[model samples]
Target: MSEVKKIATRDSYGNALVELGKEHDDVVVLDADLAAATKTGTFKKAFPERHIDCGIAECDMMGIAAGIATTGRVPFASSFAMFAAGRAFEQVRNSIGYPHLNVKIGATHAGISVGEDGATHQCNEDIALMRTIPGMVVINPSDDVEAKAAVKAAYEHNGPVYLRFGRLAAPVINDRPDYKFELGKGVILREGKDLTIIATGLMVSEALEAAETLAAGGIEAKVINIHTIKPLDEELVVTAARETGKVVTVEEHSVIGGLGSAVCDALCAKAPVPVLKIGVQDVFGESGPAVKLLEKYGLTAAGICKSVKEWY
Candidate 1:
């Protein structure tokens, strides 16, 4: 098996947001006083005037962000994923989505990746809820390059954008800026013809590893990096199924409404392949290390390998 390369997406967002702030003066940052934790500290340090520390009020922060965006400024609101989705969901939906404001929601500490913070802090159903909002663009970038591109894309694309990042470092799976992020396109990380593993966020790297593991077991699994969850890659999902008879969708999200459901909807409605959804099987996270949570919930590469091995 190949060694997993881990890099937190929160840091990627923070660094890329600074780059964005440097590129454009209109790029503003709104944090719920969690600058360093959410990796928005770099932006705050670089552009003090553009940083709005809302002092722990996630609801107010979302509203403030919407108001800022209404003034023709690009506001990237930062907070823990739990507060961003669970605490301020109504504010986010009404202020950002209903009004169709140009706000970029940079949700940090996503999934079971929030190792020690426990179930209360971790957000597995966040993406599913965010995706339900009409005109909302939900993105889960798998690497630094995608993080940067997603930042720019959210800024350029005139609508509400929700981007989730994790606390724990995951693999920097994406190697090139060779591709630009289309609002609804899923990128192919690895191509194969036996079974397909459609994945998003940190799971993309794991799915790739799982594919390799399956190959050694005489199974060739295709891997799709589903960075965009809302406006899913219908073409790629159908295409992957056509190429491979079986599908295994992975994410650090809920098994029900997250990437798994999205892929299954596409595959069942169109391609109609045998799909196995791997994720937090409809349960909240526990107070433990990320590796332990991943292992407990079967989100790790070894777990993915086991799932594919069963089918093979």
Candidate 2:
């Protein structure tokens, strides 16, 4: 059979919002002037009344979303990652995060994946921003299937959530129709011993490839695909760390405040190991193709292999 078919998390969010709208009348969508770009246009078209386009006012939209949630309504505020996390930090923190409102924040165009939109739109620091906030459930689904599952799980769970997705297409690693998600749980795509590759979001597929390459090169790598960022599956990570002596973390976001940092923090207190983080270093992205940007920032499978060769 062929390897898994790649699809972006944006496509999954678009479809899942429509599906959620069908079941819950109180499920509303609030987009901060980027419905089409964020792929929330489908929800607006399907449920016009429930969809609120809060044009260009990200900070304000977050407060309004919190208000809606306080009224026992589920509001999924959609926008680009930079605006949602960086631009609207205070509103999201005081209104939603502190109060612990049941609001679902969908931040699209995350990481260097926005490509041609350049560094201005990329939200590589969002993971660090959102993950730092208290009472916030941060998650980055790997592909379409996982994104769909995440949306459903977020809707059912009663609390504040930040679901980040990329602008580019990523391979679909999951195909389970009846998949049930328990927050803070991760999946081991392949088991190994020599080293461990801990990855999330778009990097999961690349990590899988890196692991395969490592095995072929006589280096067994245990691959842990962590779909959820906050409330992270520390148990799985600890187990993996203990199993393997060397470790590497990969993500599309920045090395400081993204998946790698979270993994490192968890692994340090619980189970420390030699960790090499594979992500964008202290630099902003330029306007280029998504794949080109990823390659330039040392985020490809080949990059992972090189890091392992040097670090481990």
Candidate 3:
């Protein structure tokens, strides 16, 4: 069997920015002294004149991005998820989100996959923060292809968008010809009637693997990849819930207010099925290898399968 290709979504974000820059003259990129880490340095190298380094001040960078958007220029403010979504919460909520500017927040190193960076840098709560800001479009792409497509889609959409990218390289799973990238739609990767596995970000690939494991045990599992989390494809989620009669939400974020919470919120109002949320259990991450952290936190495919079997 051929080895699966892997690429970090952060790299995809940078490469996509370079492509967007070439196509649109008004597409500008701003970084809070994390050009290399956030991969916006690639855009800087390609378009030196258009890329702005706003020092280490994440809040100031948000304000600058907001100002740049006023001139009809699309600015993608790049930074670590901790500073971009946590530290700059006020600016993002007021300046960009309140006025509804055409600014994109490329928040790289999201979730515990940030590895040795520890809890301070690992932003497991960014999705919840961004989702609270009314009108903010939250998207957490699963792999390279989805991340690149999300960048272009965010550029096309005329509003505030918060994009979460991972530090660890994930397998390229959506490279098939039938793949499509809609801004607010979920993709059904595998069809089954026993139960539904709704996942986002890196968990999408893991969900597929867990589905295979479940199938081996004669427990068919439907897998849905929700790349866009804000205007969550609630319709797809609801329909899948109604069909499968049970749901399991998986993500790399905290279970408090992330994908799991969003899924519960939708299901409660519409479907109201039994749910098992698999993610960070509302605790801070510690310094460790990225892969080990995932294993310890029960975010891997084997962990997911174990959880599903116990819950079911």
lDDT of 1 by residue, 84-112 (tens): 98899999999889989999999999999
Clashing pairs in 1: 5-171, 6-170, 7-170
Q: Could you arrange the candidates by TM-score from highest to lowest?
A: 3, 2, 1
Q: What TM-score does model 2 achieve against the real structure?
A: 0.97
Model 1: residues with Cα > 4 Å off, grouped in runs: 1-5, 177-179
lDDT of 2 by residue, 1-312 (tens): 876577778888989999999999999999988898888999999999999999999999999999999889999999999999999999999999999999999999999979999989988899899888898999899889889889989999899999998889998777766555667798888899998898999999999998899889999999988888898898988888888877889998889988888888888999988889889897888899999988888889998898888887
Clashes of 3: 0
lDDT tens digits, residue span 1-312, model 3? 999999999999999999999999999999998999999999999999999999999999999999999999999999999999999999999999899999999999999999999989999999999989999999999999999999999999999999999999999999989889999999999999999999999999999999999999999999999999999999999999999999999999999999999999999999999999999999999999999999999999999999999999
Question: Residue 108 deviation, candidate 3, in Å?
Answer: 0.0
Steric overlap count per candidate: 3, 1, 0
Q: TM-score: which is higher, 1 or 3?
A: 3
Candidate order by decreasing lDDT: 3, 2, 1
Candidate 2 residue pairs in clash (backbone atoms < 3 Å) = 6-171
RMSD of 3: 0.6
Model 3 TM-score is 0.99
